[model samples]
Target: MASSVSAAAKASAAFAHKKELAAAAPAPTQHRAGSGRRSKPCRVRAVASPARAPRAPSSTGSVKTAMTMTEKILARASERAGLEPGENVWVDVDVLMTHDVCGPGTIGIFKKEFGGDAKVWDREKVVIIPDHYIFTSDERANRNVDILRDFCMEQNIKYFYDIKDLSNFKANPDYKGVCHVALAQEGHCRPGEVLLGTDSHTCNAGAFGQFATGIGNTDAGFVLGTGKALLKVPPTIRFVLDGEMPPYLLAKDLILQIIGEISVSGATYKSMEFVGSTVESLNMEERMTLCNMVIEAGGKNGVVPADETTFKYLEGKTSVDYEPVYSDAQARFFSDYRFDVSKLEPVVAKPHSPDNRALARECKDVKIDRVYIGSCTGGKTEDFLAAAKVFLASGKKVKVPTFLVPATQKVWMDLYSLPVPGSGGKTCSQIFEEAGCDTPASPSCGACLGGPRDTYARMNEPMVCVSTTNRNFPGRMGHKEGQIYLASPYTAAASALTGYVTDPRDFLM
Candidate 1:
């Protein structure tokens, strides 16, 4: 890794410290997550049955006559009645996904709770993806997959992405990406659908305009036997991001700022309905990044209203016909906040918490030892494209050790062949390889969780890193001593190049 910045960058003083700018500012929102507001029981709107509740006119302020995305999707899944906030209804699940880390435990609970002879509620709806900890050298990890595989065979579950890809990396075309991405790839996640997964990031699928959320093992076991889950319609909090993001800004930054503003638990148990032109402008991948982190804000789910971009991503990629639901104009929000995207700076969540954030430029000089640029949160073609653009401009390699994960095999295939924006005849992986970095072929959730011993990029030594992956909770990526700073893929790349935390704008042309 290079030890110094390019001559052009040194002269720019992009990392110059400004104490005033670094100071944390008073929050600009009313419901800031951990801002010491008096704890209050979740605001429960009075329960109303579908028969009694009528669709409100667009101009009406009555929530009873309106429906938020969560209410609409849950009501349909209920199949028996309409749903409103605070109403606990048994909603049928469209799909249920579990990865290796949680699958074995979930299966155990299923058998213990439903009896040994009971089979999965619907074999076709259960999708298994052995991702987290699958690559570990531990026999226990491999055995977990064996357990899942055996169960799938016995139950006739077909939507299973096994450890097939680990053999040749490109061996299995059926080995979809991460559980969340694979779900979307296979069309299991769709607008107006209700999906559940053991992964908290399952909310990532909510970008498709669905009511997707994470569940615990007990809930998974229950759903396994019944294909139904009990969920109270969550009140929706709308974030209307206005204005256009600057060229250097990305969705990761926008989300970090939101979490930073709201505190990690700011939106606890509420549906985050992201609306605004800026949100509409984000591509499907970016929108997914937005929803993926809502859990960080203590949200029940995160969603963007399905639009052209959402459909364009699913067109031809999925055979499942889907219905798209939109929040009624009269849908009432628990609380609303508007942020001008153009005014938002690239932000990073500091160590130990997702909401302990600050402007990336303000912390530009903080030295880093590691950089990671892939995870379900930041690993995508668009994310790699942003990183490649920065690397191409610097005409340099990374100064710190960096890892590039492609989120899935399909994404890796694209990076393996994608030409760097301006680099002469070089692929994305080639650019990183040339910069004295490593690009692993097989993609899975690596280091995002401090996985088993054999997990690649697992932090063994105490080192500071700027990563594109979500969450910075202590020990989230690896060793508890290893501090993590969360930023955009662009920031990850820029920081890798400079050996210090950096604002991507420093390298943007």
Candidate 2:
């Protein structure tokens, strides 16, 4: 597990010295690989389809008109660009992202389909980031990354090798982890843009108010070769949350409660919109965590109507000045869902599935062996503070093993500056260090996705483990034989203190 970070450091250093030169180089109008057939320039459009004519009223005298965010974007893209849902329309992509596990696959496909003999559709529209398998603990993983590095150089890909910081390798400056998080900080992802990546969590970009989604390796290959894809417009489901969240609750619980209601597949092939008072109150980090896991519930992507929270996080990070965009006042949705945080309690998802959720109180007596407090989902700053606060208030040490991992280098970089509730709020990481918690700041896929660190040593422990990761599938974290529960950061922390499946409400009360 540690080797992944080590390998990444080496890769980062090798690539660090070239950032200045790369940045200074003028943007190329032609493909670096010199593949594919060069074609005429194509015009870009926001909406690809036109609005449908109004339908005639039925005998009931009521007309129906509703559309989802995904539908609206695709419809608009199609109408304005003259593209049908299934038609392969070649266009410039706003952002292109690929990682190690899939980057080589995409690169290979690109070479085979369009290399040397043909001209690429667009070169400036691509980005390559190595994650998922940054560390090569095995011969195969090492070879995979080597192939990727070579291919990137050949293609002149603007690669973030080994999560390097252009020139400041020692300062680290938080450029080590998942592609989405890296892209967010590097200004590759922006609002009102379309992004496609080779990873499922590519939807993570929705946090930036962009139309981002994931596709399979084959799909990515096609897009890499032709800069075009066929898309099926998705329906949108709206969530209007009102009221305030108590100390024990936050965005993770809100999403869990939703999964409990909608089931894992309830929102299949649909886009989800998280809005209203509750959403507005959430900081950008919290919103990002929520939106990052929307796909786990089988939705195309999760989004929020851009507001102050969104603007504040993106102000200086984007290439262009921020211009907020929101759903039209008359924007249509397939169905509307509402949540009241004031009345909500801690929610947990049972193991082997994310949809098997129940209130924490429903299973208070369950025993726990391990507690994890990080992942791309709940490993952000807000999550750390919430968990540390509970531990500090109780002045208790976790009786069971607990693991805390920061999603990206940036997260760890800020962990020491977090303000505690009182005493003007001490850094949560300091408190965690004092509390005897194993809080290590490392890259993505650490424990939640079984990347190698802190794996389960025994099977059938029957211990109730609490985690903040997106899914709780069989053997997801460490072992299939061990029992696992998914909860908000507060809930996981509360359980950590008690060494039993405990309700976070107890600490708050």
Candidate 3:
């Protein structure tokens, strides 16, 4: 453990030295011609100095303070030497993302406050993605996208992922579905940066070791007029998850367990930092799943410190240089909790609340009418792979109707292109077809947000559904009386096969 901590300190120092050298060098003059836009120069900020040993004395004869990853990132973004919880600071925004659901309202506020002729603080910093309300006949929903497109064109926003053809998603090459997934896929989520989005799930990017959180339309408008936001530094709750994860469990199950332990309002306005061996073993997608539902616990943000796994995932995704930060060995926390993941089992959130948790095996008698496997939380490539693994193991058709919606166009393509690890070269598409599940729909936030009356696979009647979505509240998926059970992809697939809330262990073991 001591050796590992020393290695981390050395790595952080090396990154700081590299950043300093890069700052002193001349800027490159290359343009992203493929996207018809010029790449922006890396903006240098005050880099946090390498942390000292726990309780070590400083040159001034005072004990140096230890900072958490969240605090260090905020300090750099706010251009401060150090910061503590509850301190209000003005942080420079690295990325400001807005989607169709909140874009129109944010734009309205921007125009009303900054004037119609006033230009945005930075065109390239703003990302407008039209994910929700697409693939629907709702005139108002269609109008929302038009409003976003007009605004992007007027502002010359370079990162607008627009979808024009509602009939077929393939016709729109620039379209990327689901803003959170699209943000990470398109290289907007860099380590040690500050990202504020109009949607609550923006915290998903925290998996990349960044400070990401949601903002209201008014806050977004302020960010549009000025590339800065005044935010309070949040006290962080440390969660240490040790031991190897069980085969029947996934990141979704782990997060559900945490939320269940602490309730929905437990982490209100607090940063939730996940660490330990279990987290380090998770892939980038699994780490994303862990951070995606922090908002469900009313957390201000969720973060996993960047490591080689994070750097590897960002290698081809982003061209921008970034320096990752880590929490000091003695970093202070508001509270701490520890869990042994190997001893845990599959769990789910019952209807009416996200924190209403129960063991999947205990709820085996609960009959489900349908199953859904989609949304930013559970619709990534790994998610579908996990589901297909269950179906492949069971070797049986689903008793209930199963719906699959990939979160993004890239994820959709991956479903068809990538092969399941041990399925005799069979892909997720083939497995879904063999299981008699519905054909994978075009990538979007389909049925997750209950967009319209005609939404594909939406529950219009009072039906019980076992879903991989984050929320299980009444009417979260469709009808107010409809019951939704939030579970892991593995559990959802197993339940679909039996038409009951079944535990994945029944098949995996």
Candidate 4:
């Protein structure tokens, strides 16, 4: 960890003060989650039932639209466990993921709740990722890692990534990132399976057609306690997208638009089924980024119907034989909306809130000081490519102090080998080096969270910047004074090149 910047550092002095930015962040959105007029309470069963069955299996002998990804997984897992949807029956979990901060707490809870040795029903099924506090800026966190280390050693858990990568303790070797990305990359997530984790982003695994969701510490404790947790079949909502996304817009833009439309908690307890040609056009990486942020929209989870893109990504990786699942055409959906992406513009979410979004062009004049290009949400190969495209095209050195951290070591290795497209003499590393940007690639959330050596400095300085990360909440990316605009990698790269908040579209123009 570099001692150059402290976690308390504020954004640049030229930007808004912390108090003012914080004020803008908490401004209530028009469509606050859970604030909508209550429609009559529809039974979960009623919502799950289809109006009609498939006429017959298709040529591929697969059901494209039968039940939603979430519905199918819950139904199958229930059948295997002799339960039914909406029965609230506790069933076996196909996978369990934990991070350091909550990992130790879950262990203690598991011992107390189950009243036995620290024994998980299946050691291999459990993945322990020590990302959050792995850097251990505090003495208590260090102690917690010791406890987690001892527990993993005792249980013979195979997936454990420690803090040596980037100072964040959650940086484990076998575990690359937030348990969600690690599971997806490592083939731990499979179609039609039930997965639970301690982190909210665990819903990210839903991209692979799994019924993955997050739970509270107590809930996770119960899972480890009994190797199972009860789930009520969630209703499904569908987003039918159309048209091609503009150059500046990507999966992140689509999700931000949805979050703005629905507010943070719109989907509350409903599963999101992403259908439409636009969704099909998205690669697995983009789909995963979309599903990864569903929790932010208050969806139980999000899903993209398994397609060739999904199968190709998972075919060789999954140890378990892979069978794709798709929502039925006549599948019951609680609500649905169609999005036209062709006309969509780059969107930005004002801080202290993710749902506070508007067209990026509307805020183009906003000045920026720092540009961040990493996070579980934005730290993928595709994301890096998008950012690199902007940087290469600009031919401008990074005007501000910029940083690029890989979401995981694996991602770093995958992207690091590739050369910067326009830099005839430079690789990605060389490009960042020339621009005076710090390029640190390693495991886990290195600088996003207010972990030591990666935190914000200068408490109330007003600074604006683009970030490729989830959540622009109050004090989320560091100082409350800094104005953080959540954007895609392209936007971040553009800002890094110009030293201000410049939309990628402008460069296209």
Candidate 5:
């Protein structure tokens, strides 16, 4: 069985790398009409029928109202001429997603309210993925996935990513790990669309220039019965990030800095709109990382205006056409904050809170027992590449245990395939192996949410750990007494080498 799993992983790695290489080629040029603005929104040709396409902003009289991207998306989804902040509106849902942890409960609610015999409004638009607790011996955890499988089969859901074999993840080719990453990878995320999931990090999809947020089970049930949801338009808080990103700073640091500036509840019930040269410079995955933790800062959703980079990432990922929107030049903002990326340094959130920020260098004396590199926030292909770069540069074996969990199967494959730039020809997997780190485990949301007691890499003891995952609340990763320092992949890897909270610049420089 072990041999078969190994062989399957190897074969898939080779095949996945070929596709990655093809995708690495330069994207086609996207022409744009310059409006003399600092940021120009990319015009997307709508492929959906006229009814499905959002109505263009009205241009009837001399007076016109400016709308932010969040307001514009809500207006289109609700079929309104215009909308204002704090207004309750019934909006059309582009996609409804549920997963193992919440799927069973959401399913129960849907049946209770809509009747078991009633069919979903749109089977094609609902996405179900089982990721949270797939790799465990706990019966209840395993049963949760079974519930999702039966529900998906009964509903005839078109986009259900399921896994039946717990022993060998490679056996389940249909299964994609981690709900947030899987959603984007499977092409369910598109620009100018409304996406609601049972998970809070659903806001991660907003990075694609969409209105994506989390909804309760009851709200999800309502959307299940009818393809519409009653939502309130949130006021916009504009964050302008300028200057080139420093070598040591990743999107994780930028977001950590933002959260530290504004307390966890600072942006409560408001849309956080990220703009400016620095934001535009980020790739899709980096943008996703930036938006993923907005819920921690009490944000409604986070959006980056769609441009060439956004179009490039979605090229082969989706066949459905989407209309990307942007904030009007005169858009009203509840508040505006500006940041200079060049001035920022690598930072981490101390244990027990995502807002407890501190510089990496400040925590150098803090010893760590383990270093974790995975989660929707830091477990992408590029994230692993960054960690590998650090490890290769350090040229030292880890002094502490370093656990690796890829967010999805594709990432798992990439670890074994994608070569690290400037590392000769070494892949991330090879670098990790040489660094004395644990072999990258099967892709899943392992230990991020502190699943079943038997979960791999669970913090069973009261030890300090440097982790790339988000959230460091009490017992977030496992033991209540465990201390977790939330950090970027580079910092996590550097800490692993020294068994202390070391800054990546120590090695990178």
Candidate 6:
């Protein structure tokens, strides 16, 4: 019995000794594993939660008391309050937009990488719009649409706005006109959110004070699998446009002039924030037009802070709870420039590049073969009305074959009762119908992409085309031999009347 007790005492003492040694150990295995080799180890913590963390300092020496529009959106997306420009952060994506042009390729890569049966990160976050090549009779285009339709069906995504929604709105209650417009109008793009689209003009949604930009198919495929994207917070260039009223000039003229002055690469990879009395004077549709062409200027995005116009547009359209973000009064900017719109004149982008611009009246002698008055940049009801006033004032037939493609079905629907800008005797719908302008059945990207079976007005022969679309690059409108001139809808209508590039003011007087 004494021997048994002694053995038990020895075993208990050994265990107590082990406990002391463990308590006196230098550190845990994990804590000391890489500390001996390298001080900084790639240790990953738990997956990032949506709860915001403490804000880091801004790139500038100033401690940012308030965030800019871009900063707020990115910070919130990355689950942090403060973000410095040029720092790459992993951001949660609010919307992943894929159109017919890039949706198939994105889907192909997504399936190949994630496996066919692998589910998307967030099915409802994926938005598919088959607008780029839908009007074609080509089998491949149809197949592309079918792929998107099938994928959305399999994923049970509710945001896929397909061709049926183009005409039969009842078929899909979530129909929108264009991807950019649909994004905002349908409440997908909210302030303080991150929205990425497959097309460059995705910047258009930035008009609502959101962080919206374009990504290629590979990046989109990754976002499809994981609802996250690495973003380098972009520095913003603030443009202050304080000016008196100008009769002839519109938002298109202002943007054209800005592009001409900045060159296409001036704001490369940077955000262009439009501010001042002029931009504030614009309505939501006009602000969208201003932001849509930022891609042409090589900007990461173009934004206008949330204002009354923006607030009103989103009021009834969005039921999604969202916090509105704006640039602090003392927001830090990479560069700042001011322009007086009162001194600005009507402008047009010459052939080859969007930055190659000239005053509209200066290029009046330049002849045109066709006039296109539609695209995301110039398809709104306001654009149509602005153009209609010129046609009504002329009371003349269109000298050139003009094409009017409304930006969205809603814009098209509103056109039935559009008044001429000056409240002239006739409606815009009547003016276009009487002017021999060809109107497509539904609103779409149309000829913006110059896809196969090319929609309405494409260059069949080498000709000078004055268009209201955003870009004017070589072969942008289907013909390398064809030259394109970009202008406002008002300017385009005046040019269509004279069969040459003319200033709308000349006709207005």
- On TM-score, the candidate that comes out on top is 3
- The runs of at least 3 residues in candidate 3 whose Cα sits more than 4 Å from the true structure, single-residue gaps closed, are 1-64
Score candidate 6 by TM-score against the native.
0.85
Residues 194-299 of candidate 5 have per-residue lDDT tens digits of 9999999999999988999998888998999999999988888777788899988899998988887676776778888888788889999999999998888888
Evaluated at residue 339, the lDDT of candidate 3 is 78
**C-alpha RMSD of each candidate structure in angstroms:** 10.6, 13.2, 8.9, 11.7, 11.4, 18.9
Q: Against the hidden true structure, what lDDT does model 4 obtain? A: 0.68
Clashing pairs in 3: none
lDDT of 4 by residue, 383-435 (tens): 88787777667667888777776776677766667766566745666656665
State the lDDT of candidate 3 residue by residue for 1-509, as single tens digits: 01111111122110121211011121111111122111432332343334444544665565445567788889889988678888999999999999999999999999999998989999989999999889889999999999999999999999999998889998899999989999999989987799999999999999988999999999999999999999988877777787889899999999998887777877788888888889989998999999999988888999998767777777678877676666655567776666788888899999978889899999999999999999999999999999999999999999999999999999999999999989999999999999989999988888886778988889999999999988878788889999999999999999999999999999999
Q: Write the per-residue lDDT of candidate 2 for residues 318-403, one digit (tens) a residue.
A: 54533323443444555566566788888899877887888888878888888888766887767888888888887778878888
Clashes of 2: 21
Candidate order, TM-score descending = 3, 5, 1, 6, 4, 2
CA-lDDT, candidates in order: 0.78, 0.65, 0.85, 0.68, 0.84, 0.76
Candidate 2 vs candidate 5: which has greater TM-score? 5
| Model 5, runs deviating above 4 Å | 1-63
Clashes of each: 3, 21, 0, 29, 0, 0
Error of 2 at 360 (Å): 1.2
Model 6: ten consecutive residues of lowest lDDT: 19-28
Q: Who wins the lDDT comparison?
A: 3
- Model 2 deviation from native, Cα RMSD in Å: 13.2
Query: Please, what are the lDDT tens digits per residue for candidate 1 over residues 260-344?
Result: 7777777787888887878878998898899999999888999887766776677666666566666655556666666778877
**How many pairs of residues collide in model 5?**
0
